[model samples]
Target: MMFEYMDKMVMFQDTPEGLTADMGWLKEAGENGWELVSSVPLIAPNRDGIAYGTVGCQMILKRPKPTQ
Candidate 1:
């Protein structure tokens, strides 16, 4: 079940302060059992000065326990 859901899942990348998402999508994802795993921030220096990037959260969800 988890694998099936994950296969149909989609990933999104958003630039820092570039675009925003509506609350409805977040709520729907949560309701469908999507869990947040991690989030990261990216930074880079451009000709202007500095630029910021956002690596949105990641989620690893499984039905059966993951084996090590």
Candidate 2:
């Protein structure tokens, strides 16, 4: 089987709007035949070289490749 992943999901500090926005993307992905596999929050060091915790998120989804 073959599949594809979409990592463009976004979240703004895990706010309510951010949650809803990501949910919207997830919903759209399902409509396009993708099944959610995982969702992970992303964090990175700031300019001061310190992690401020979850700053964003990444979503993993996959579905069978279309017949060719």
Per-residue lDDT of 48 in model 2? 100
lDDT of 1 by residue, 1-68 (tens): 22323422223446597744344554566677665444343344578876755433334432333455
lDDT of 2 by residue, 1-68 (tens): 88876666576644665533445766787899989788898787889989977767787888888879
In terms of TM-score, which candidate is strongest?
Answer: 2
lDDT of each: 0.45, 0.74
Residue 10 alpha-carbon offset, candidate 2, angstroms: 0.9
Quote model 1's TM-score: 0.35
List the lowest-lDDT window of 10 residues for candidate 2: 13-22
Clash pairs for candidate 2: none
